[model samples]
Structure formats: structure tokens, C-alpha cells
Target: MSARAALATALDRIERYDEDIGALLEVDAAGAAARAAELDRSESHGALHGMPFVVKANMCIEGRIASCGSRMLEGYRAPYTASAVQRLIDEGAVPIGIANMDEFAFGSSGENSSFGSTRNPWDLSRAPGGSSSGSAAAVAARMVPFALGSDTGGSVRQPAALCGVTGYKPTYGVVSRHGLIAFGSSLDAVGVLATSAADVERVLAVISGADERDATSALRAPFEPAPARTDLRGLRVGLPREYFPADLDGRVRQPLEQALDDLRRLGAELVELDLPTTRHAIAAYYVVATAEASSNLARYDGVRYGARIAGDGSLQGMFAATRGAAFGAEALRRILLGTYVLSSGYYDAWYLRALKVRRAILRDFQAAFERVDVLAAPTSPTPAFRLGEKLSDPLAMYLCDVLTVPTSLAGLPAISVPCGCAAEDGVELPVGLQLIGPAFEDARVLSVARCYQAATEHHRRLPPLVAGGVA
Candidate 1:
């Protein structure tokens, strides 16, 4: 498709489905048309020519609102484009709009957005999984070929699992975080959501590289794509016993087992192993994530950019009033948790220990990679739960990410690919099979997902809404 044609199709999809899905917070139809026109007239093109995509709200796009899905930064325009995004633009991928996200990229359910929750396309009553909810839903609904999202913990992978699309979180330093608004500086990873693993690989090729603007960006040569895998022969796929406990939901386990069988049939050798630190991942993730969040979110105290309420004509009161008015309930909860962890006499007990646990998690992966090419597991413990199901229970909501957090904490490369569907009261929901690789094995992770998708039709299944079976 021509660039303009691609954007037209995306806009049409957004118009037909976004109102019901709540996937997009804003649509840049006119700007995208202009960029598409420029692409059509240009004689030269980059790898992603004619591609249409969206940026998660937390990522900057010059002149666009980088709201981070919170009222505090609502209407706050981005002054400069993010380094990763600019690279895509350079390669001719057009950005159609900003995708919705949890407030400050804080929540897993996407319900924390001040803008409103993004409904899952498969079932409007269900969450698409989040803070990257909109990105995953948009791709699932065919509104865009792919989109960007920031993954802290299981944000990107979890949503992609719930939404039935491919989501990839590259190694920590693979993508520059220069334009991404932070939740957890150490754990946050800019990721991608797409209709297929191959599409995701194409997008990542353009965005992954060294960036002088981001100190954390790895000083490395341009990304070299992994050779395509025709079969899984000689590939050892490790199954960590910790990832599959006796309590795993039957619906999730069934579909994942089918996928594992498919992998085995494709000639992959399944080896069982142990990652003893798996149970501590959630506790360590929250402590490390929230502590970093507290420090990163401190900039929005009504003194800097974002919402402000001048209260009682005093600076302290103004700070309190502004934060009180702008931050969402979940955002406030995390901030408090983060602050308490970083408080005097508590930092060593909480934050420091979490860091130590993070290293242990990394070591666990390193040891596993010594014996296997990749690790296979479920992305989320269950299929997409109904919206508001876990909202009232913070711990329950946090536990939903149990399976995916370990990879995030370890700063490894991982991808969630649609394995099959699980049924809930006769309604079908997508389940994801997560593939993880050691640090910097991003290409291998993507390659494995692509190979699996090549054999099975699971990733080909469409949501009811997208298939026109539902209103």
C-alpha cells in the first residue's frame, strides 16, 4: 500500500472501532495525511516505508500532547520527538496518534488512565491488559500495523497477551528511553505491539541502536536481524517449574500446553528447569519500580509542567493541592508505597533488597540460558479478566503480572505471542505463550515467536469485534 493509502485504512479502522474500543486518546488524521503525501512524493524510502503506527502517550512526538494518560500532563505538548520515534519517522513509518496508557504508565489493567480505560477489542467488557492497553488493542483491532509502548514490569507483554497480538520488550539498553516518560527508570523498557512477530521485528530494526541523547542506551553497532528459523530443531526450550505452579488457571494452562506441544512437534527440545527467585519477582519489582517512580514523578509537583492548584497562597499547600487534584487513585497509591520504601531507615530494608533480588533474578536467567536457547511460559497467569474485576483489589491486580515480571526485572528480551484461546462462560479470550531469551537475545526471542507463528494459526485468530461477530 502507498503511504497515504495505509494511513487512510488506519483512520478508517479507528473511526469504525475506536469509539467502542477506546483505544486511541487522539488521532492525527491531518498530520498523518501530510506525512503520507510526503512519502508518496519522495523518490527514496527506508525499510518501513508506508507503515502507519501510533506512539504510546508516554513517548514524545513533537507538537503532540504527551499526556501520559493523566490529567496532570493533559494538554502538555511534546517539545521534541523521542529519539526512538524520530528514527521510525526517518525510516518512513507515519505516526497516526497517541495511544492511551495507564496514568504515568503505572497500572497493569489500564484502568488508571485519567482519560478512561481502553476496552479490549475481543470483549468490550474486558481490559486489553495495560499500561500499554491502547497500543495492544489498536494493533489487535487493525487500526495500525504496529505501535510503541513503554513496558515497566509486564505492561507491554501482558496487554499483548490479553489483546492477542505480538508484543516485544527488547533488552534494557536496546532502545533509547530519551523521550519516554518514566515510571521505573531501571525497569522501564520501550517496546512494540504488532499484528505479528515479523512486523514487530521490522519496526524494531529501525528503532534499536545507540543514542548519545540517552546515557543508558547501549553503545553498540546497529541491530543485526536474526536469521529466520524454518524449524525448532536443535533449539532447547526451557520450561521453568516456577512459572507453572499447581495453581495455574486451567484455561491458560490448556492453551499454553497446546502451544508447547506445537513447539515440541516442530522439533524443539523441552527441558525442565528451576528459577527459584521467581516468587520474589513481584515483591522486588514493585519495590524497585515504585521507588524509582517516586523519584521520577517528583518533578510534577505543580512547580514544573503539569497541573497546578495554587492553594492557601502557600507553596507547600499549592504542591499538595495540585498533586491531590491531578493524580489518579492508583498513581497516588504507588507514589505513597514508593515514598515509604525510600524513607529513612526503610530504604535498606526495601529498595536495596529489591535491587539485590533483581540481580539474583538476572543470575537465574543467565544460568538458565547456559542450558537452553530460550525459556517458554505463559505471559499472564489467566486470560484477560473482565474490566473492573481486579480494580478493587490492588494485590490481585498486581499478581496478574506474576508470570512476566521476572523477565522485566532481569532486563532480558522477551515476546508474547498469541498461542490460542481460552473460554470464559462461552466467550473466547486469547492466551499468550511467552518466549524469553537472555540479555541481548532480542532477535532470537523474536525469531522463535516468528517460527511458532509460521506453523500454527493461533496468532491468526481474530477478536469477535474485529471479525464482525460482535457489535
Candidate 2:
């Protein structure tokens, strides 16, 4: 299909289905159509030639609104396009619009968005996962072939798992973070969500590399192209015992075990290993992440970026009033938590110890890598939960990152692939099998996911919302 036709089809699906799903915060039909028309006239373009995609609202596209699903920057327009996004646009990919995300990329479930939570396409009553909620939902609902997301914790992978799409978080520094709105800058990495790992691979190829704009971006070779075959012969896969807590739901466990069997059948050897620091990951992650968030978010004071509140008060009072009015409950909660951890007396006890724990987590992964090529585990403890299910319970929501955050903290590469579905309330909710690899080994991760996807048709399965509407 031509780019124009594809854009029209995508817009039609969004209009038809997004009312209930709430996947998109904004749609640039006019911009996408104009770009598509221009591509149609050109005789030649680049790899993504006329393809349409969505970016998580946190990513800046010059002159476009990037609300990041929060009121703080509600009408903020990016003065320049994000470097990674610019690379894709350079290769002929058209940006359709911005996808929803947890406000400031802070929440685990999509419900944290100030605008409204993005519903899971599998069952509209449930959350799609987050903070890349809209990115995953848009892909799952078939409104776009792929979308860009940011993973700070399991923002990309968890949502992809819940929404039944392929989501990948490349090694930290593999993709530049020049324009991503900061949320735990140390843990944040640009990621992709799509129907298959192969599609994610293609998008990564075009955008992965160092950028001068981002000091943290590494100077590295372009990722080796994905292998042509899905064979996993002689590949070593590890199973981290900590990832499978005794309390894990059978619905999620069963599919994960079945996926392991699928990998074994594909000629991969499974090794049982231990990441001893896994249990401490969640605690350490929160301290470090929130502390950094507190530091980074200080720039958003009402005097500058965020919406200013005109209250009758002194400068200090105005700062308090503006921030109080602009930031959401979750955002305020995080900032306070962050501030407390970084306070003078508590800094050494909480913040310093968290850094030590973070190092321990990294070392654990390094030790495990010595024995295995890739590690496999469940992406989440359960399938998509009802909208309000865990929202009231902050601790429960934080635990959703239990299985996925270790890899993020270690700066390793990981991908979430739909393994199978667990029946829930008379409907089958998708469960994801996560694959983790050592830093800079993104190709192997993608190859492993592709192999599993080929042996099983899980990734090909679409939610009824899109399947039933297809003409």
C-alpha cells in the first residue's frame, strides 16, 4: 500500500477504536498526510520509506505538542525534534503523532497519565501497562505499525507484555537520549514497540548510535544486522530463580514455562542461575530513580517550563503554588520521596546505599552472563489488571517492575515477546516472555526473540478490536 493509503487506514482505525482505548493524546493527520504525499511524489527515499509511526509524547518533535501525559507541560511545543526521532524521519518514516505515557514517565501502569489512562486493547477495562502505555496500545490496536517509547524501569517492556506486542529496550547509551523528557535519567533509555521483534530491529538499525547532543550516548559501532535465520542452535539461555517468586500467578507462570520449552525445542540450552541482588532491585531502583528525578525535575519550576500559577504570594510561595497546581499527585509523591532520600542526613544512608545496591545488581548480571548468552523470565507477575485494580495500592504497582527492572538497572539489553495468553474473565489476556542479554548485545536479544516468535505465532495474534474491524 502507498504511504497515503496506509496513513488513511491508520487514521480510520484510530477514529473507529480510540474512543474506548484512549491510546493517543494527539493525532497529526494533516502532517502525516502531507509527508506521505511528498514521499509519494519522490522517486526514492530511505529504508522506512513512507512508513507511519507514533512517538511517545515525551519525545520532542519541533513545533508539536509533547505533553508527556501531564499538565506541567500541557501546551509545551518542542523547539527541535529529538535526535533519534530525527534520524527516523530522515529515513522516510513519518511521525503520525504522540502516544500517551505515565505523567513524566513515572508510573508503572498507564493509569498515571494526567489526561486519562490508556486502556488495554485486549480488554478495555484493563490498563495497557506503562509508562509507555499509549505506545503499546497504539501498536496493539493496529492504529500504527510501530511507535517509539522510553523505558525507565519497565515502561516499554511491561506495557508491551500486557498489550501483547513486541517491545525492546536497547543497552543504555545504545540510543541517544537527546530529547527524551527526563525521568530517572540514569535508567532512562529510548525503546521501540511493534508487532514483531523484526520490526523493532529495523527501527533500531536506523536510530541506534551515539550523538554529541547526549553526553551519555556511547561511541560504538552500529548494531550488527539481525541474523537471517531464527535458529538458536548452541545458544545458552538462563532462567533467574529470583524472577519466579513462589507467589507468582500460575496463569503467568504456565505460559512462561511453555515459552521456555519452545526455546529448548528451538535448540537452545536452558541454565538455572541466580541474580542474588534481584530482591533488592526494586528498593534500590526507587531511591536512585526518584532522587535523580527530583534533581532533573527541578528545572520545571513555574518560572520556566511548566505552567505558571498567578497566586498572590512571595516568590517562594509562587513556586510552591505553581508546582502544586501543575504537577499531579503521583508526580508530587515522587518528588517528595526523592527529596527525602536526598536530604542531608538521609543522603548517605538511603541514596548512597541505593547506588551500592545498583552496582551489586549490575555485578550480578555480569556474573550470570559468564554462564549464559541470554536470560529468560516472565515480563510481569500477572496479565493486565482492571483499570482501578492497583492504582490505589502504590506498593503493588511498584512491584510490577520486579521482573523487568533488574536488567534496566544493569544497563543490559532486553526484549518482551508475547509468549501466550492466560484466560481471564472469559477472555485470553496475553503474557510476555522477557529475554535479557549483556550490554551492547542487542542483536542477540532480537535474534532470540525472533526465533521464539517464529516457532510460535503469538506475536501475530491481534486483539479483537483490530481483528474484527479489518475489512
Candidate 3:
């Protein structure tokens, strides 16, 4: 199909289905169509030639509004595109628009977005997960072929799992963060959500590698295409005992166990392993992530960036007014907690201690790597939950990410692929199976996910919303 045709088709779907789902925060329809037309006239198409995609609101795109799904940046226009995004453009991917996200990438559910929560495509009453909520929902809804989201903690993977699509979080330094608005600098990663692992891999190859702009970006080998196989052969898969606890929902537990059986039948060895420090990951991740968030978010004074609110009296007054008015409740809660931990008297006690815990978690993962090629686990404790189910309880909402946060804290690469389905409220919701690899082992992780996808039709299964409307 011509680039313009593809762009047109995606735009039409968004117009038809997005009103109920709220997957996009902004739609650059004219820009995308114009670019698609131009690409159609090109003599040679790049790797992604004419494919349409979406970017999370937090990532910058020159001349486009990068709202980060908050009132603070609601009117802000980006002066430059993110390096990762620019690279994709060079390969012929046309950005459709900015997908919604938790304000400043904070909450575990999409409810934290100032623009409103993104509903799960499977069931509009349920959350799609966050802070990559909109990106995951858009892809799952087939509003776009794929989308980019930043994963800090379980922002990307959790949503992808909940949305029943493939979400790939690259190694910490593998993708540059020059344009992603900082939430947890140390834990943040630019990730991709798409219908299949191969599509994620295609985008990953284009966006991966070093950038002089981002000091933390690594000089890694660019992605190369390869043949995939379903046979596991000599691969050893580790099941972290802590990830499958007794408290896990029965719906989620059953599908994941069956997936293990599938892998076993395909010639993979499943070994149970213990990552003793897993219990402490949530506490430590919150401290370290919030501490960095508190520091990074300090720049949003009305005078410097974002929307400004006139002060009643002084400069400090203006600062407080702007942030207080612009930031959502969840964002403020995290900021307050982060500031408290980083406070003078509490820094050593809370921040420093969390760092120690982080180190221990990393070491635990490193030790596990010595024995297993990849570690597998449920992506979330349950499938998509009702939108308001955990919104009123922040602690309960945070616990939703329990299964995916440890690898995130360790800066490891992880991919979430649909393993099976669970019936919730009489609707069959998708359950994700996550495969985590050691740092920078993104390729291996994607390979395993692609192999599973090839062997099963899970990833090919579309949500009722998309499937019903598409034909």
C-alpha cells in the first residue's frame, strides 16, 4: 500500500474508535499525511518506509505539542524531535500523534493522566495500564501499528501486558533519553509497543545506538534481521519463585502456568529460581525513582518551561502556583514523597538506603543470569482491571507492577508478549508472559518472544473493539 493510504487508514480508525478509548492526546493528521505523501514519491524507501506509528506525549517532536499528558505542558510546542524519533523518521515511519500517558510518567494506571485515563481496548471499562497507557491502547486498538513509550518502573511493560500487545523495554543505555521527559532518570527507558515482537524489533533496530546528545546512551550494535524458530532447544528459562506468589490472581496464574507447559513442550527447560531480594524491590524502586523524579521535575517552574501561573506575590509564589496548578494529584503525591526522602535529614536514611537496596536487587539478577538464559514471569498480577478499581488506593495501584519492577530497577531488558487469556467479568482479557534478559540482551529477549508468537496465535488475537470494527 502507498504510504498515504496506510496513513489514511490509521487516521480513519482513530476517528472511528478513539473517542471511546481516548488513546491519543494530540493528532498531527495533516503533518503525517503530508509526510506519507512525500514518502510515496521517494525513489528508495527506508526500512520503515511509510509505516505509521505513535509517540507517547512525553517524547518531543519538533513543532508538535509534547504534552506529557499533563496540564503543565499542555500548550508547549517541542522545538526539536527526540533522537530516537528522528532516527525512525529517517527510516520512513510517520508519527501519527502523541499518545496519552500518566502525567510526568508517574502512576501505574492510566488514571493519572490529566487528559483522563486511556481505556483498555478489550473492555472500555478497564484501564490499559500506564504511564504508557495510551501507547499500548492505541496499538491494541489498531489505531496505529505501533507506538513509543517510556518505561520507568513498569510504565511500558505493564501497559503492554494489560493491553495484550508486545512491549519491549531496551537496556537502560541502549536507547537515548535526550527527548523523553525525565521521571526516574536512573530507571527510565525508551520502549516500544507493537502488535508483534518482530515489529517491535524493527523499530528497536532503527531507534537503538549511541547518541552524542545523551551521555548515558550506549554504543551497541544496530539491530539486524534474523530467522526465528519456535523450538527452544538448549534454552533454559528461569521462573522466579517470588514472581509467582500465592496471592497472584487465579485468572493470571492459570494462563502463565499453561505457557510454561507450552515452552516445556517446545524443548525448553523451566527451572525454578529464587531472587530473594524481590520482596524489597517495590520499596527501593519507589524511593530511588521518586528521588530522581523530585530532582528532575524541579525545572518546571512557570518561568523556565511549561505553563505559568501568575504569582500572588513573589517568585516562589509563582513557582508553587504553577506546579500546584499544573501537576496532577498522583504527580504531586510522588513529588512530595520524593522530596521527603531527599530532604536534608532524611536523605541518608531513605535515599541512601534505597540505593543500597537497588544494588542488591541488581546483584540478585546478575546471579540469576549465571544459571538461566531468560527469566519468565507474569507481566501483571491480573489482566486489565476496571478503571476506578485501584485509583482510590495508590498503594494497591503500585502493587500492580510487582511482577515487572525488579527487572526494571536492575536496568535489564524485558519484553511482554501475550501468553494466554483470562476471563474477567465475563470478558476474556489477555494475560502477558514476560521474558527478561540480562542488561543489553534485548535481542535475545525479543527472539524468545518472537519464537513464542510464531508458535502460538496469541499476539494475532485482536481485542473485540478492534476486531469488530476493522472488518
Note the Cα lDDT for every prediction shown.
0.91, 0.91, 0.90
Off by over 4 Å in 3: 225-227
lDDT tens string, model 2, 1-471?
688888888899899989989988889999899999998888887889877899999999998888889899998989899999999999989999889889999887889898999999999999999999999999999888899999989999999999999999999999999999888889999999999988999899999988999999989866666666667889999999998878889999999999998999999999999999999999999898899999988887788676888676778777778888888888898899999999999999999999999999999999999999999999998899999999988889999999888888888999999999999889889999999999998998998888788889999988987788864
* Candidate maximizing lDDT: 1
Compared with the true structure, what per-residue lDDT tens digits does model 1 show for residues 106-177?
778889899999999988999989999999999999899899998889899999999999999999989999
Per-model TM against the reference: 0.98, 0.98, 0.98
Arranged by lDDT, best first: 1, 2, 3
TM-score of 1: 0.98
Model 3 whole-model lDDT (C-alpha atoms): 0.90
Measured on C-alpha atoms, candidate 1 has an lDDT of 0.91
Candidate 2 matches the true fold with a TM-score of 0.98
What tens-digit string does per-residue lDDT give for candidate 3 at 241-359?
Answer: 99998888899899999989888888899999999999999999899888899898899999867889986968999999999998888888888999999999999999999899989
Worst 10 contiguous positions by lDDT, candidate 1: 462-471
